[model samples]
Target: MAITHFTSSNSFQGYHITQQFDFCSGFGQFIDEDGNPASFSMAKERAMQQMLRAVPTEANAIIGFRVEHSIGSYVHSDYNNCILTNLITCVLVSGTPVRMEKDMEQKMEKVLLVMDYPPALPIRPYLVTLIPGQNESTLVQLRFFSYTSEPISALQADIVLRTVFGEDIVLPDIGFARIRAQDGEHQTGFFRVNLSDSLFSAQSASVRIKKYVCGSALREGDVHNQRIDMRLEDLFDLKRLYGNDAVAPHVVYEGGWQCLCGAQNPTDEKTCPYCQRGGESRQVAHASLLRQAEELHSACEILACLQAYEAEHKGSLPLTFMEGLEKMASTERMFGNMKKECMKFLHEHLEAEEAAAPADVPDLSEEDQAAMGSDAEIPILTPNPTGDGDTAAPETEEDRFTIKSPFDDPYWK
Candidate 1:
């Protein structure tokens, strides 16, 4: 996990010359237990193996490598059900490529693995409010943990809810716990229980955790139990324990200047002079096209276009805005100005929507609000053009335009 004798000093001439390079590869299908296409975690070990190969054979070590991964999903109709399958996983790795001194010794130390018991209860409770009506409902989220020293093969639990009025609601067989043994981490699962209006009116509720099974045996025989009183005031204080900061940013599209046929037209030009697609229809078409463009371009292509632009313009934008846009369009299939405009449009749209909503409707918590305002945007997914369930490598033309030697490039030197 640690690298010794590796310094990031740009003036270190004694060491081998270093240049940055991009490496991309694909691995694994995104299939769930039920054969549905779902996003799944790519094992760390498998990802590491792919990254190791990214370093050239001539290089002694890889330093300051950063990785970005994305899963592409493809949907198709099958037997009246829409089936989603993992199209491909794109792994993009970038780092300072270098050769180490022959005499320098490198060593890796052994580390001990530690295992511990999982938490018995949720770190905190989450409250969700249903619509205000006769069949009004409320969701109470619960987190369960494992009792065994070893990682549990599977776990299941039943929860019994008793109201102050002596009414009992039993929920059985609630958890799916199949954590890996080598992971050495206890299983933590979340289960949500829906309570009707009558249940929510109860003065107090008791939760009994029963039939606690782990790894083929009952770990706890009705031992874990908790009781909580439902408050009328707290009903209005719905809060999400986890924030949406991790969610991808929404990408917006703006249309006016660029034409459908890739022609550079002024904003005043309401219609694309070449394609004849213009006005409101053109704007909608342009947004869809931009999303398609975003999907077609890979990270490598964007990085290449960015590097090429910087190299030619002395770290400044091109003399003609459209010229720089053209370069980006060639690689990324979209221009920087377009993306910026799209972001601005998205912001205004969200603000307008929020302003128009009725005040009585409860707003998301502060954390959730902040996450929505964050600058980060999610990666746009596009249909795979290859149709082979593999991400195509960056075109050779991109590689040809890049600086080949570190000594010649000011950034690398």
Candidate 2:
């Protein structure tokens, strides 16, 4: 008799056992060499014991056992027609055997978020009050509003005063405030601004409010940063109070596309130097949404970028920013450009969504509306290289396909 056992990759050991017995008569008890009774049950017990002894002592337990039995009969001429019988049995056991003490060492690793979601809040300089005191300084009041539904436990901002004439003034650090979600619309606080008459007379001035909101319950760590620029004249009735003829300067808020590394790049830049992300209007709009979702930064900036893109693209909005990123990643053009942090943040926060329909409703003339209903080719006008009002016809297929070498050009010659 022969027995074999196969061990799994995780198994500590393998065991095999085989036993054989000979009998002259069928269905009769026989005596062993020690005069003990020999039976199939006894032979099975001996096979099991041998298999158990062969197993390593460090093995936890045995599992997945199989047993096989075979019987043969042969005629012996010397036995005068008596038939001799031989019986063989085999048992096999296979399983993954593991030590309980070593199980902790084989544990799988876990991934964790490096940065927490930023809090949402809007802050601005709301009012200015003249304090009755020996000093001529005025009290500047700032209002804070909760951007999200949750109550804002704490908030702060870095205030910088800049004059329209390009003079930068350093301001005191603003303190924190506890603001309720419902009461945020009416909340206001004061900061003292000491301004000399000469400083006030010089052109218009603006306040740059760099607001920071504490993280919500799901996120923890540093405050979320957002920049807001407001004109001092708009916040207060300076003409009525100060009799200063300073007009408010045209306020151009800093807004642009966000890079993969979360850096804000100018709209004119074609590529981001930090992460090498595309700086086109579509790419910038998508990156801005990612910054808003991940870092809770650039909400207003992102809205501006999206609005500009929509206005430029015939009132058509791109796909949902996250969905657009996914579609772009599926193509070879944008493959591997997305960072792991950005992908992880998107996976944990954003839900699958369909593209939004364009919101703009254009007013078209009767002839234009009729053209839309027909399959007639529309005339597209191209701009001339010169600043003149001459309109050039759209390029034909031949014009587009035709290429000229640099040497053939008049300028090159």
Candidate 3:
């Protein structure tokens, strides 16, 4: 139940609190629409969230709520050389922490907000937060809230329910172990997560949102969502909508199932010949996900570079670029050769960019250095024969590309 669902008497109140409670005041300043704090209710919600923190538990509602808000503008800059104004909203909320009655709070619940940044990624999963849910011997609720326009009926991701003792319970069972959307048409999804006995024995547990292979940020130990604490919102955001279902690898079966490693094997085969993975091995899926993420990331980088080049040239890729790309990509794509080709292309491109880059300025002459103390408006540039403006009076090496022909560079016997 939501705080809004709480009526005057049917208030946001219960006995079992959602998270570990602290006595901190709820107050925050947020940049919101002008004169329209209602346009963004999240400002108020942010203030209330400081009251509760993730622990081995979950709370359904809040009680004894008090909220205050103000919307106003501040002079970011004043007239003279800079005059700018911006609007901001401040929300202050205070609430007595309470949990649902035993009937309602028996099960702990964790809500992960679905999000996408640096858009066009193939897989975007709900957060794997620090305190995802309680690991105690009890059924826990897991929820995904996506402010997506269209319904996502089929979405899947591999999740590892890690215990406090450093044991990971892989969701291998296709039936109940998957972290995926509800079977039918739905905008949001929920699951009653069941963990192993070993996990429950530990004090607390966390959900590990695996993306080390997909993005560089996560690989460098940066927070996946750019924040440690996961934010949960009850309201659906219509203006900011995300309805992409390429969240994970879709299950495909062609007579015999395909391995995550992109290899096609017959049903009788116990292991994949290309990747050497067991037919029922979870490692196959896990490794496949990582490889897919890496490929997607590499593709994005190459695509961005191509797009930038096209934008600068105001048209399609230059003939030479296309020819070079075709030649580089002529290498085998299966296995890991594709990545090597991409790296080779990038290395060559870097050399070309460095050659086109401007040369650095030269140090002042002995006489000019001495003249620095005087009011001498010393010239920094001189025209060379090239007629192009540069810091030097003489031409450096002209940018050149000469590929030695195999037929001419060395005589073949």
- Candidate 3, residue 120: Cα displacement in angstroms equals 91
Worst 10-residue lDDT window for candidate 2 reads: 107-116
Output the number of the lDDT-best candidate. 3
Please report, in order, the local distance difference test score of every candidate based on alpha carbons. Answer: 0.36, 0.35, 0.38
Candidate 3 lDDT trough over 10 residues, lowest sum: 234-243
lDDT-sorted candidate list, best first? 3, 1, 2
1 against 2, candidate with superior lDDT: 1
Kindly report which residue pairs in candidate 2 clash with one another. none
TM-scores of the models, in the given order? Answer: 0.19, 0.23, 0.19
What stretches of model 1 exceed 4 Å from their correct place?
A: 1-141, 145-147, 162-167, 172-195, 202-205, 213-220, 223-413
- Candidate 2 achieves a global lDDT of 0.35
lDDT of 3 by residue, 1-413 (tens): 33332222324334433353332357767774365536337776676575444211344554555677887777766567686677787887665443455434443233233333212222233333212234542233223322222333323334455444766566531111222233211211223344544543342223323332211123221233321121222111110111122222213466664543334567777664533445655333323332343344353445455555557656434467555655544544444345555544544554454356453233458886786656643122111212111111111343111212111212111
Clashes of 3: 6
Candidate 3: stretches off by over 4 Å: 1-24, 32-40, 54-58, 78-80, 102-413
Across 153-216, the per-residue lDDT of candidate 2 in tens digits comes to 4334444444446775545454434232232232223344565543332232233334444344
Instruction: Return whichever of 2 and 3 wins on lDDT.
Output: 3
Give me the runs in candidate 2 sitting further than 4 Å from their true place.
1-134, 144-149, 176-187, 198-413
lDDT string for model 1 (132-176, tens) is: 221232333232222233334333444444445777666565543
